[model samples]
Target: MKAENLAKILKNYTSGWVSISKNYKKVIASGRTLRVLLQKLEKMGNPDGYLMRAAKDYSGYVGV
Candidate 1:
């Protein structure tokens, strides 16, 4: 896809991560969020590596 389209998709993915993070914060207490985040990280192929790393870290902290 074009760079602009990729950027837009990444933006949406970031938003989804934010929402998922919020839910993980509220519901996961055993690192499940961390695991899920790590899984997402593994699936990441975008240039926004930092965001994915942040999400992974956050989820790791929550044990989810």
Candidate 2:
């Protein structure tokens, strides 16, 4: 997925970590931190095109 699209998906979550699928149609995982979310996703065995982002603020957009 394009970085722009990834950023757009991330915008939906105000805080915490988010895991998005390749098609950007589903959420694979979510958590309070990148490490926690990564560990959770890892258990599912490295998803392709999956993207992770840490949202630190709710007032504006943030990137991974």
Candidate with maximal TM-score: 2
lDDT of 2 by residue, 1-64 (tens): 3544444556567667777776777677887888888888889897865555556443464444
lDDT of each: 0.31, 0.67
**Residue 25 local lDDT, model 2:** 72
Candidate with best lDDT: 2
The TM-scores, one per candidate, come to 0.23, 0.58
Model 1, runs deviating above 4 Å: 1-32, 45-64
- Candidate 2 accuracy as lDDT: 0.67
* Cα lDDT tens digits for candidate 1, 37-61: 5565456532132222223223223
In candidate 1 the C-alpha lDDT for residue 63 amounts to: 24
Q: Alpha carbon lDDT of residue 28, candidate 1?
A: 17
